[model samples]
Target: MRTRALLTPLVLAAVTTAGLTVAAPPALAAGPDISVTNTKAHLDQLQSIANANGGNRSTGRPGYKASVDWVKAKLDAAGYTTTVQSFSTSSGTSYNLVADLPGGDASSVVMFGAHLDSVSVGPGINDNGSGSAGILETALAYAASGQTPRNHVRFGFWGAEELGLLGSKYYVGQLTTAQRSAIRSYQNFDMIASPNVGYFVYDDNAVGNGVRDDFTAYYDSKGLPWEYIDVQGRSDRAAFRSSGMATGGIFSGAETIKTSAQASKWGGVAGKAFDACYHRACDTNTNLDLVALDRNVDTIGYMVWRYAAKDYGTTTPPTGSNLLANPGFESGAVSWTGTSGPITSGAGRPAHSGTWKLWLGGNGASATESEQQTVTIPSTAATAQLSFWGRFDTAETGSTVYDTLKVQVVVAGVTTTLATYGNVGADTTWVQRSFDLSAYRGKSVTVKLVATEDSSAQTSFVIDDTALTTT
Candidate 1:
């Protein structure tokens, strides 16, 4: 659940097609609408995973690993590259899964992510399976259309988020300085299908406001009204903001009781919490409001395509050559090795722009998932940059702590930690992060993304859109 904050000033902004809202490129006319039926199908799978494993996909549990495997398999079949990253905490080890699509401007990246792990007490279908399924369906729809975009897109399925924010933090800490700068924006969806739902948008910062506005515009376009809610640091967005990255996302409601006004607008029980089954044993697939899930998932698809295909008039288009081969995982994880756990490909979630991405962790307990690629830097190059987009969702329960994701440079036998992440608490959005590799100019170095879990009951981490450039 997200921590609550005072609502900021509500400013409803209209979506304009003129100057503010950029039109989609010729290559990507109006993107395909996501299928609500398909999104609900994902939720069904998650529920099945939980039922078959332990009645709950809690971190460090078999159900969690099963959930990750199910999602990865779907993404792989859809032509996306995926990776599984591992992290540890007092509860135990956990994982994060990241998927990337091939072929888009790597410089300007967009991301969307959701947490796949649930609390120990329940299936957590409405609490987060709603979001996970919504994003998953959107990714699959993108793959089915086979459309190209102007910006890169990535998707992340986080682990151990209910415990704290371990997985997402680890992912953020592992980015190279150059990678962080390439990300254009990150959007997150947490509890979008609560039984007694409300259309609440995160309105805390400029980035958040923009996301809220986009959602509001979507609702307005459908003749629906939305209210603003400030979740200051309760969820995954907190991890992005901690690293000075722009972040935004949506949530329905958690344990907070709805008011009569909200009931009038959204039509649910006025005094009940948006999700009375939140974190409880009854948070099964049956706990969701399908109408809410359908609408939010559609909105998710619309925003993802809008950001990925439209020219936001920001950074210049990428030019110079990339030093690393298969930088975007478009080539099916070529020139890379899984040093520990498995790294694969899939079309499971929104990517920076292509049809694939490399995913790490989400396997099981006490896992050490990692992948590395060796790149040679030209001697004449004065500066080198390593960039990528990443998203993570982690958790901590009780006294358990410690889950990590690391980006490191290995030259000869020595490994230097370029970035390190642990216990980010919550961040459900993709952020572009980068690290300077100038010191490795004129040499061959192994760039690695490592996910480590301390014990069990931890979370997950994800990464994509990798690029190494020297000029």
Candidate 2:
């Protein structure tokens, strides 16, 4: 959670007005609302913990350890193997707790965290007690659901946040390079129930685009007004984002006063601070707005449930550069694989460069067509890349992913889809796309571009001037 000094409002525009390109996803069954009363009860317990120890669950303090133990005991009973990571801080020793749910692909993890320790002021309930309780309940609910996940689920409760994001930074710093890469997304929640609340979503990095879209879609479904928060170095997300993982999360306003316009939109007091008790002693359970708390918790639960099963392809998107023969189809089917029909010029869809671009799936029928080439990267090569100019003109509309062009890589007979471009963004001009293929060095693999069309609308993926090169 943020202290007043660190609460800088980077960008406060509504989600719809934030100039984000939201990819349409199918409606998510957000599941039933997980006991808001129970969530609130957790807030009360944290409050009591603070009241008993020192009126604050500050890092290196007895209340903080007690808080961690209380939460760990609950998770242990729920069948989670938890880890408590200890690190040194100005306060002497601080800790971070991580609990990984059993089952699911550990290779790709979906993580969420909230700062558990609070300022040494009052009981710090709304400052972060709200976020901690919400995430705790979500974790418990997922454990009890009996639903096996596709992606691994992990939850974290960090110590020493008010002392400048120390615990989260330590947790992230301890991860190995491969472990860092394995985290596909990280969601951080802090100050979620400010008395005067305004909904906010994290937005940064193109990699976070898909996750950002999911949050906005959830809010839109609930008729909730959400804005984008830059987050920068304000919270735990900055730690993971700096380590090269895509991150997204929810935040209610803190420290900043609610403007008349914001108050008009979200129904809060116009001229008052979002959390009049940001890091002060008055930040107790009474500092919360249950209505906003309920909505944000449900949204977090919705994302956790959906992403646990999200398919991130069989392998990381193939990354490298110029190893394929007839890379652009300029020489037709002589050095490539797939339907020869896509190599021709006159069947429609202008080429990105030469007249021989690969044109797939303009048949307006339920069909699939592809173009691929086998390439080998030397083990000694330090860098490789795959680049191409392409565009899709689609007859389909809305966010429904009707027609798609799957960019895939095949290694050891396993095809991993690097990306799936859908029918939403149609264009009259070509766009350039590239991926790092260096990860496939020392192996020969088939890099394929496949397009599939629905029975109704026609979508054409026109490709030209492709190159996979090593340097």
Query: Which one wins on lDDT?
Result: 2
Query: All candidates' lDDT scores?
Result: 0.73, 0.80
Task: Point out where model 1 deviates above 4 Å.
Answer: 2-31, 314-471
lDDT of 2 by residue, 1-471 (tens): 756453455776664543566555446575558788899999999999999997988887898899999998898888765777778888868888887775554457789999998887777898788888999999999999887777778899988888899999988876655467668899989988888999988876455878887888888877677888787788888888888788888899888788887888789899998999888999988999999999888987888898898888665233443555556665444344455367776846777777778888888899999866655566777787888888778888788878989999887668999888878886768888988878987765678899988898888888888887777
Q: Which ten residues in a row have the lowest lDDT in candidate 1?
A: 9-18
- 219: Cα error in model 1, Å: 1.6
TM-scores across all candidates? 0.66, 0.65
lDDT of 1: 0.73
Tell me the deviation in Å of residue 115 in model 1: 0.5
* Per-prediction CA RMSD (Å): 14.9, 20.0
